[model samples]
Target chain A: MGEILVKEKEIVAPGDVLASGMDYIPTDGAFRDGENIVSSLLGLVYIKGRLIKVLPLNGVYIPKKDDVVIGRVSDMTYSSWFVDVGYAYDAVLSLKDASSDYIERGADLTTYFNIDDFIIAKVLKVNKSMAIDLTMKGPGLRKITRGTVITITPQKVPRVVGKMGSMVSLIKENTGCQIVAGQNGRIWINGTVPDMERLAVKAIKFIEQNAHKSGLTEMVKTMLSKEAKK
Target chain B: MSYNKRFDGRKFTETRPMKAKTGVVKNAVGSAMFQIGKTRAIAAVYGPRELHPKHLQDPSSGRLRCHYNMMAFSGSGDRVRPGPSRRSKEISYVTELALSPVLDLSAFPKTVVDVFIELVQTDAGTRCAGICAASMALADAGLKMKDLVCAVSVGLVGGTPVVDLNYEEEAYEEGAVDIPIAMTPRDGKFSLLQLDGDLSKEDFEKALALAKDACQKIYEVQKNALKERYVEDKK
Candidate 1:
C-alpha cells in the first residue's frame, strides 16, 4: 500500500515528497522519483484517487489555443497586426482574421486597429515555436475603449472567474460595472460611476490576492456588501 | 601554529547566522535577498521571455543567463570596479551551472530566463551566497524547479575541517583552503565545487561532508522563506 505524505490543499515546495510507493501516480506539477512522488512546484497539493497533482500558485502567462485574452497592439505589418498578450512572443492578428469584413491589401491597418489599441482576441493557434495566432472575429471579441485595465497574477485567473463565473457575476450585480476578464490576467472594467468601477476592481484584486484561501466566496461577498454601502 | 578556537568563536562545523526573504524587488517577476553573517546577496529573476540577440535563441529549449556583480563598496578591502570583470564573469558562469540542473525550461523554447545577482556586502563566500539567493528568486518567479539549491563555503582552516569559513579564517596565518560548494538538497548531489587552496585527500573528504550537512540547513531556510511570503499575505 502507498502512503500519502501530504494532505489535500496543503502547500508544498518543490522536491517535497507527496507519496511513497508504486501504487501512487504523479501528474501535472507532481512527479515520480524512484518509489516516491514529489512535488515539482511551490503549490497546493491535490489528490484524486491514486493520482497526485499540484496546482501552481504563481507563473507567467503561457499562451494556449482557444483562450480569450486581452492584448495590446504593439506593431503592424502590411498584412497583420502584432499583438502582445503578455507572453514571451507577440501574437499575430492577420488581416483576414482581424475582422469579418474584407480588407484590402496594404490598407491603412492603423485606421482599424492602431498601435497601442487594446483588443480582446482569441487564440487561434500556437505553433511548436510558441508563435501565437489570434482572431478577433469571435463573439465578444472587440477593441476595448473607455475602460480602466488592471492585471493580476495569471495563475489566479480561474479563481477570479470562479465556479461557472459566479464570482464575476456577483461583482457585476453588486457594482453595476461592465467587466471582461482575460485568461491572461488582464481585466477591463467600465461603470457609470468611478466608485463602482473601483469597487469591482477591488473585488477582483481581492480575489486574486486571496485565491489560495477557502471560503473565499463568502469573504468576497461580505467585502462587497460592506463597501457598497459606503 | 595550531588553530584552536574559531576567529568568531563559532564551532568548527557551524555556519554563520542566515536570513532570507522573497519578493524583495517589486518590479521583478521574482526576487529575494539572502544574508549570512556579513555577506549579503540579492537576486532577481526577469523572464522566460523572448531571448534577444537573434542568434542566441535556442529552438529546442529555453536558456538561462546569470549575471553576478558586486557593488563598488561591497568588498571589505577595496572598491570593486562597476562593470563586469573576469572574476565576475567566471562566477556568473558557475552560478548558471549551479542552478540549471533543477530548472525545467523545455516548455519555453527560444526564450531566456535571466538571473541577476548582486552582492551588497561581502565577508567571504560571496559566490555561494549569490547562488542561494538566485535559487530562491527563481522559485519565487514560478519557474519549474526540481529542488532548491543550497550552498556554503567549507574547507580546512589550519587542518581543521570547518563549514562556512569567514574572511578572517580565509586569511589565517597557518593557511586555509576555501572550498565553495553548492548542492541540490533533495538529491544530495553537488552542483558546484571550487577550491582556492590545497588540502589533503582526507581533509577534503571531511570538508565535503561538512558542506553537505550545512547545505541541508540552508535548504530549510530557503524553503521557509518561500512559504513565509505567502503566509504573510494571509494576514
Candidate 2:
C-alpha cells in the first residue's frame, strides 16, 4: 500500500513528497520520482480514494477545449470577431459560429458584436499554436448585457463554483442574483437590487481569499445569511 | 590586521541588518522589496501568462525571464545610466538561472514568468540582494517552487573572510576577493556562484562555508516575509 505523506489541505511546496508507493496514483500538480510522489507547485494537497492532486494557489487561466468562458470583444474583422479570453492569444469568433442567422460575406460584423462587449462563449478548438476558436451558439453562451463583470485568479474558479456549484447556488438563492463564473476567472453577477449585487461580489471575493480552507461552503452560507438579515 | 578593524564595525562572519516585505507593488501579481543594510532592491513578478513574440514560446515548458536594472539615482556619487548595460544584462541572466531551478516550469507549458528587479540603492552587494528579493517576489506571486533562493556576499578583506562587504570594504586594496553565492536553504543546493578577483583554494573553501551560513540567516528573513503575506499572525 502507498503511504500518504501530507495531510489534505496542507500547503506544500514544489518537490515536497506527497505520497510513497505503487498503490497511489499521482495526478495534476504531482509527479512521480522513483518511489515518491512529489508536488510540482506550491498548492494544497487533495486526496481522494487512491488518487492525489494538488490545487495551485495562484496562476493565470489556460483555456482548454469546450471550456465555457467569459470574454470581451476586442476587435472585429471582415467575417470574424477577436475575443480576449484573458489568454496570450485572442480567440476568434467567426460570423457563422457567432450567431444562428446567416451573415452575408463582407457584412458589417460589428453589428452583431461590438468592441468591449462581454460575451459568454465556449471554446470550439485550441490548436497546438495556442490559437483558440470560440462559438456563441451553445446553451448558456451569448452576449452579456447590463451586468458587472469581475476577474479573479482563474485557478480559484473551481472553489468558487464548489462541488456541483453548491456555493454559487447558495449565493444566488440568498440574494436572487444571477451569477455566472467563467473558467477564465471572469464572473458576472446580476441582481434585482444593487445591494444584492454588491453582496454577491463580496461573497465571491471571500471565496477567492479563502479557497484553500475546507468547510468553506458552510462559512459562506453563514456569511450570506448574516448579511441577508442586515 | 588593517584599516580601522572593519569599516562597518561588524564581525568577520556577521552579516548586515536586513528587512524584507512582500506585495509592495500594488499592480504586480507578486512583489517584494528587500534591504540588506545599505543595499536595497525591489522585485516584481508578472505572468505564467502567454509568452509574446511567439517565436520564443517553449512548447514543452514555461520560460522564466529576468530583467535587472539599476536606477540612475541608486548608485552613490555619479548617476548611473537609465537603460540596460552589459553588466546588468549579465547579472539578469545569472539571476534568472539562479531562480529557474526552483520553479516547476513543465507545469506551465508555453507560458512565461517574468521577473523585474530594480536596484533602488547600492552598497556593493546589489546582485545578492536582487536575487534574494526576486525569489521572495516569485513566492508572493504564488509560483510553486521547490524552495526559496537566498544569497549573501563574502569578501576577503585584510586577509580575513568577511560576510556582506560594504562599498568601502569592497574597495580594499589588500587582495580583495568578492564572491556572491545563492542557494536553496532547505537542501543546501548551490544555484549561483560567481567570483571576482582571486582567492587561495583554502580561502575559497572557507568563504563558501561562511556564505552557506549567512545564506541560511537570509533565508529566515525571506521565509518570514512570505508568511506575513499568507499566514495569520499568532498574536
Candidate 3:
C-alpha cells in the first residue's frame, strides 16, 4: 500500500510530482511542492500517451530443460512438428516429448498437433542442433482449444505476465477472462466472446503503459470495467 | 520533395522502430540491451564495491569507470574487433562523465562503479544509446543515484533537428551535421558532448534545446525499461 498522488490516467509532465519513497522513478517528466520533482513516468499510470515500443526488464525467455511453454504448432514433419515460440527458431515439440505414447511410423503427426493447435508442453531437451523437444503430461499443460490470442513483444512477455503470475492474476480477476499466457508473448484470452478478447488486449496495453508506476491493481480493474461496458 | 516524404522527409531523422531489453544476462549486478532503429547496445553494471588497481581509486568517494566496446561482429561490414579504439575510449570517458553528475558516489566510499557496454549493432549514436542503457543497468543493480541519466543524438537535417539519430540519418549528411549530447533532463545538466560537421552557436543552442526535450521523452523509455526490470526483480 503506497500513497499515490497522480491518479491513473492523469496527464503528467517533466517536473510533475511522482512519489516519495525508495521506489525509483522512470527517467523522464513532472513537478512537486518543495519536493524533488520526478519525471512524468516516475510512476505508473493508465495512458498510452506516446510510447515507441515495449521494453523487456527481466531474464530473457530462454528455453531451459523441463520448462513449460504453450506454443502454436507451426510446421509438421513425418515424425516432428515445429512450434513457434517467437524466437529465432521454431521449437520442435517432437513425438518423443509426448507421453511415451505409441504412434504408427510415418503417420500424420499433424493430427497430434495439426497446423495451429495450441499446446502446453515441457522442454525435454534442446541439443546443440537447436532442436527443442517438448512433452505434455503436467497439469495445465495441455492442448488449447478455443480462445483469442494477443501477441506482444516476446521480450516484453514477462512484464505483461508479471511475477509469479501476479499481473495476469490481476487481469483475470478483473476481466474474468481465462488467459493462457506464453513466455513467448503469445497471450490467448478465453473471453466469453470477441469483446472479452479485445478487452483483454486493451487491458494488457493499459498494464504496459503504466507498468513503471505503482498501484497497478486499481488501474487494471478500472480499465477492465470501463472496457467491459464499452 | 517526394510525395512519400516524412515530416520533413530529409531522411536521417527518420528513426526506425526502436527496441530495448534489460537484464539480458545473469551473474551481473544489472544489465540492459537497448536498440534504436538499427543501433543496439548491451550494457552491464557491476560495483559500488571495493576498488581494484588501487592506484586509480578515489579515497573520498566512489569512482565510476565506463568501458564502451563494440562487438567485432556488431558492424555490418568489416567486423568490429574487440579492444578500445580512440572513439571507444573517448565515448567511455564521456559516458563516465555523464553518470558522474547524477551519481551519489559519496554514498559508497573508496569504491568503483563499473559500466561495461557492448554495442552489438552499430547504426549511429551507439555511444548515446549505450549511455542510456548503462544508466538503466546501474539502476537495475539498485545502486543509489540522484537521477537517471539519458542521452540522445540530435542531428541537423536540412536545418530541422531530430530526436534520435538513425543510420543514413547520422553519417553522410548532405547539408546537416550531428551533435551528440547527454543530459539529465530532470536536472538540466549537460554531461557529454560530441559533434560532427559544423553548426553556428545558434544551431548549437537550438540542438541542445531539442536534445533536452528529447531527453525527457527518452527518459520515459529508459524508466519503462528499468521499471520492467524492477518489477521483474520484485516478482
Tens-place lDDT per residue, model 1, A125-206, is 9999889999998899999988888999899999988899988988999999998999999988989999999999999999
lDDT of candidate 1 over B97-192, digit per residue (tens):
999999999889999999999999999999999999999999888888899899999988888899999999999888999999999998899999
Which numbered prediction scores highest in DockQ against the true structure? 1
Provide the lDDT at A104 for model 1: 72
Q: What TM-score would candidate 2 get against the native?
A: 0.88
Model 2 agreement with the true structure over B86-141: per-residue lDDT tens digits? 99999999999999998766656688889999999998899999999999888777
- Per-model clash counts, in order, read 0, 1, 15
Q: Please identify model 2 stretches exceeding 4 Å from their true place.
A: A1-5, A15-25, A33-36, B2-11, B49-62, B73-81, B104-111, B144-147, B185-189, B233-235
DockQ of 2: 0.36
For A78-165, candidate 3 gives per-residue lDDT tens digits of 7777887644357776677665678888766656678888887777776643446777766777778887776654445666777788
For A1-230, candidate 2 gives per-residue lDDT tens digits of 78998898777655567998998999987878778888766667899998999887776678799999999999988888999998866899988899999777777777789999999999999886677899998889989988799999898999899899988898899889999999999999998899999999999999998776668898899998899899
Candidate 2 vs candidate 3: the TM-score winner is 2
What is the alpha-carbon lDDT for the whole of candidate 1?
0.92
Lowest lDDT block of 10, candidate 1 chain B = B226-235
* Residue B69 local lDDT, model 3: 94
Residue A124's lDDT within candidate 1 is 97
Residue B193 error for model 1, in Å?
0.5
